[model samples]
Target: MNRLPRLRGQLFERHEITVEKDIVRARQAVGRAMDGLGAKAIRKTRLVTAASEIFRNGLNYGGGAVALIHCDAGNRMVWVDCIDDGPGIEDMALALRDGYTSGTGLGRGLGGAKRLVDEFDIVSEPGVGTHVRLAGRA
Candidate 1:
């Protein structure tokens, strides 16, 4: 399921920051997004690092997208989901490689994203979009 809980003090935040070459804004947006979802120092750092990459991908490559930050009460988890309706990845496997890029990309992409989180889920289609959901516990 792509749904997260709406618990109190949850502080879920959604944003559609512009992807106009301002990666700093993207990073801050992510940090602010996870301010109080029961995140600790290490976990929040990991999540923000992953989020910065995804946010940049959305802004730089995709035609921009939305970021979803929410709490998973059932699992005591904090999740971040970024969705973009940009030109879908042509080769999912290749794009996931540690150093794969089609220009305007840093090549870290999915590999780095996966390493930063406890759980990662990704789905993409050529003409559709990309949906990435990452989870980390408090």
Candidate 2:
């Protein structure tokens, strides 16, 4: 497997969330990494959904590529950043609206994802692509 290096802290390992079977792989990796790291069922589920949302959005809206970098933030918190280099969002506010969709999706992805995480940051430019970082206590 032509894979990226896995980063680990204690029993936790970080991974890149991409397409194919890697999304499932990444979810399992996260579950293993957060087990007993104070990751509650609700928070873990939320983070997983948030992770899935960003990856799908990156493939659909971005340039068919996305990078999800996960790491331990010490103190039982895990941080993940979903980065992409594609034509960026045209309007941030509009894009974040509950029922906004640039494609055929239901349009609730970004907004719903925001509700699932403790911290959410999205940055993009017309030609610069998009980067979304999500952090939460697991």
Candidate 3:
């Protein structure tokens, strides 16, 4: 008879991981969550890709943020919430448009993040903070 491996549940927290050039670390963090949840390779890749971009935006433009990865038996989810007390987006509609980057161009911006994730939520206030939440199940 074959036996299934026992499942493990864990909650992880990463704080103050700068978002500017830490794309590699952000990818690693999301990859860990995907692997821990037993996500297939393809699914894991997609999730990590989307998450890496989101993390970068939060770090580079938004200033910085944190991540919360949660896993349980039979399912896994990653929650990335980036907060920055900087000049928040004055026009969210314009900000979410593709190819709208405050710095550079040539790639889809926040809109790409929204399209790539299973779930996405964002809120911001001028002179306060920008909060972006992205979640995916595997």
- Model 2 lDDT on a 0 to 1 scale: 0.69
> Can you write out model 2's per-residue Cα lDDT over 21-132, one digit (the tens) per residue?
6666665665555565668888888887887787778767775554454556465666565666778888999999998999998899899989998878878777877777
For 39-116, candidate 1 gives per-residue lDDT tens digits of: 677888897888877777777777787777776565767777778887778888898897889885678878898899
Per-model tally of clashing residue pairs: 0, 1, 1
The candidates, ranked best first by lDDT, are 1, 2, 3
Candidate with the greatest lDDT versus the true structure: 1
Please, what is the TM-score per model? 0.80, 0.80, 0.80
Query: Cα lDDT of all candidates, in order?
Result: 0.72, 0.69, 0.68
- CA displacement after TM-score superposition, residue 102 of candidate 3 (Å): 1.5
Report lDDT (Cα) of residue 9, candidate 3. 54
lDDT of 1 at 112: 93
